[model samples]
Target: GDRVLATAILDRVLHHAITINIRGHSYRLKEKLKAGLVRLEETATTT
Candidate 1:
């Protein structure tokens, strides 16, 4: 993956951006989780 090349692009994209943290289960994955089919671990997002 061209992560290094994309870093500059991402920096510009996030500049002056207002981010909101939305915590809670995703309704889209509700059925999957209930069926024991989805991942339960929480992974940190890349900056």
Candidate 2:
């Protein structure tokens, strides 16, 4: 009974959800790249 209620609530919540896809370089990582603190290869591996 508890699981059914929880699932119903989750379904209602996700019904109105919107997915956003941000396309761009991160500001912090861009600065780090400029400062030579983080390498491009490092970001590729970490993310």
TM-scores, each model vs. reference: 0.51, 0.56
Candidate 2 local lDDT, residue 9:
97
Residue range 1-47, candidate 1, lDDT tens digits: 69986998889998999988988766766776687876566322411
Best by TM-score: 2
Worst 10 residues of 2 by lDDT: 16-25
Clashing pairs in 2: none
Residue 10's lDDT within candidate 1 is: 84
Residue 28 C-alpha lDDT in model 1? 65
Give the C-alpha lDDT of model 2: 0.90
Over 3-24, each residue of candidate 2 has an lDDT whose tens digit, in order, gives 9999999899889899678876
